[model samples]
Target: MTVASPLRFPDTASAPTMTKRGWWLVVMNILLPGSAQVLAGNRKLGRVGIVATLVLWLLAILTLLTYLIWPSTVYTLFTQTFSLLVVQILLVAYAALWVVLTLDTLRLVRLVKAAPNARAWIAAFSVVVLIGLTCTAGYASVVAGSARGALGDIFSSGPSQPPVDGHYNIMLLGGDAGPDREGLRPDSMSVVSIDAETGQAVTIGLPRDLNPVPFPTDSPLHSLYPDGYGYEDRCDVDVCQLNSIYTEVSLYKPELYPQAEKQHSDPGIESMRDALEGATGLKIQYYVLIDMQGFADLIDSLGGVDVTVSEKLPIGGDENLNGVIDWIEPGKQHLNGYYAQWYARSRHGTSDYDRMARQRQLQDAILKQVNPVNVVSKFQGIADAGTQVVKTDIPQSMLGYFVDLGMKTRKLPVKQLELVPPTIDPANPDYSQIHQLVQEALAPATPTPTSSK
Candidate 1:
């Protein structure tokens, strides 16, 4: 009876045949990231993909807004909780997601022999997308790896140092360790104090000859010396010197700073930090030790800094030897690496105080020159140069925080103080006066109220 009813069945021959290649599906996936799934019987996944893509775009927009409108909030988050491991994991997950989406799209893209040209175009598009995705992933991985290596090489992992009075103090040391020198001797010493909230910064430059340096009460140096670093024993033959802290600890008194190995990874710098902290009356969280020899290369990588040469600064010279080969003419000059290093370190015809001021000016000029565009353009070269140029105890986990703080600080004018001559006697520095100066330097600037018309 059913056969007698004319065998009514769906017209299978009238239906359009789906070929192996669906070029349009691949194109759809490329455009919308989920449309291929929608057409290939994965509506739920397609919706998820769409939602995820939208969320990602929304997050990007929000991040940009945060950077522009609420930089403080962004800085806080970065300093408090940002981690490189988390960033790397997220990057890997994103790359994996892209790979999955590409594979799924390819699967949906069934080939049609009749539309060979269309298939070829789709294949080409897929190839291009794949290459782009792969290159992007590779680049991200390289950057992450470079950062990880740099951090590991430069910083030590230890308990996070708390800020003092809502300010994080970092001791920057420009070490001049030549072949004849006994050990690393920091010629230039400065304490960089950064306000935790506002990112306002102040640089307190301490002369190299600063003597009778006090030690923190908690430091073993305080216990051993009791009075000062070189009160009982001198560093340079018969005189106590501040620059001697690095060489003395690293070469002469390693046993005294055993904790430095575990905490800071550089006992010399760590000892210097402890002494500087006590002298400055600021809790130094970290130390950035720059090799003076490599300073030129670092500046060169930044395309040379444009500094206003106030006087005829000697170039290519050391403290003891008259290596003055040239003089940077008094004017606004674009100084390359060699000249910039000399500008920062040369004391040929200038006093230590003048050199210090020039060093600070050079620092400011370099900061102005090292903009984001220049940095991005020379990222690889800079990273390579940085490896040899500087060392620090700033942990990788806190790198992002500092980077954000630095960005915030770049907008603010850098305040400077030199502990030289009439300001404060280096040999007999008044501790009370030094502390007061630090307090005043860190004091918040009074806001000028708007004049009501």
Candidate 2:
């Protein structure tokens, strides 16, 4: 009875407890995030950490599944500014939380006195290293994942397209469609031949009005129109414009392209690539088709491209294409999306030859203006427009290689060649001469050797 009255607390201050936890707790934090916190008696923080990690993991899995099952939806999401912002915000928050949890784990370790001397220092170092590694790895993973989704969306899985003559020849098509017209038309076309080893490139522009188009032997059009794509036997009107290949083959003559039918993809681009190869004398490996109407958005995303306009250029057109909407003045001017598109497309008073030359000049301007910082800043906008405006046959597997190659190419001056007017008449193109021009354009740039003797 007397002992009970003493209100004895059994030596609570001197209670035997673990002075240190081994490096295992740091490892646990690395692997399972909040596990170390939970073990150190911070159940609330631990639970929150675990829950966040699980949610992120679930989201990653769901994103991968959606990309595989419904790629179009993924593409839409990737392109949307709001969606990209949300994703970027989530990633940043997640990274911050991960770093906070790691620091908290380190704090708990210190409070528990679980690591001593060198062990404590080692644990601290581990937390710092983990924080750095996690942040870097996390961001990289997000970028890579987004790129994968984008590549898949733009370039559908297709047959193996190997490089031809130590280079990948991609046809760049500027498609223009009008409500008044029966079908889509490629108003501008170019073949970008890139040297695989040196990343040297030549952009060879093919005049859209090129008539009496030739077709490759393996192409279905060749079998049907053995001599040329000219409508000599088929129609009274001259229905042999290179641009017509899209509408004629893609819409009217789908049954003719059995290979494209087998793949269940656009036969128009395939046929056009074949025609371009026959015209340029280069084996076209793939094609990237972009809607010309969407060119403004892309230009805006790039901030603006600078070009030296020698004279006034018109903008906009009417239902009957009767008058000009606006005019871009002369000299070196920074042109936005609207003006840049018009600069490339304006042909009311100007000849097709002038328009083609302007298009190539605009291309050169874009290549020069694009830089890494701006690219990152405008990535979301570009990505959004890219999905909607662009389509290609460049496979996902080769995206990294091409991205790297593009960077290298951008650093170097891009050689430009245009088959317009006096160079080679589009209305009556000399097939052999066009082929010869392509060969000469693609000829490797002579190396400026060292002078050390």
Which runs in model 1 stand beyond 4 Å of their true positions?
Answer: 1-27, 34-130, 223-239, 300-303, 317-327, 369-377, 448-453
Error of 2 at 352 (Å): 0.9
TM-score of candidate 2 to 2 decimals: 0.70
Per-residue lDDT tens digits of candidate 1, residues 1-453?
A: 353121122122321232222555566666776656755646777777666667667867987899888665654443332344555566676666666676777665554432545556667777798679767766666665665566566665665677788999989898887897776788889999999878899999998888788999988678766788777564543457888777767776788777666775567887888889888988888888889988888888888889888888666657654666888899889989988887887677778889889888988777666777887566666777788988877865576577778887889999998888899998788989999998999999999999999
RMSD per model, one decimal: 6.5, 10.3
Model 1's alpha-carbon lDDT is 0.74
Can you give the TM-score per candidate against the true fold? Answer: 0.76, 0.70
Give candidate 2's total backbone clashes.
3
lDDT (Cα atoms) of all candidates against the true structure: 0.74, 0.74
- Which pairs clash in model 1? 20-110, 20-111, 21-110, 21-111, 22-110
Clashing residue pairs in candidate 2 are: 20-114, 21-114, 79-384
Largest lDDT belongs to which candidate?
A: 1
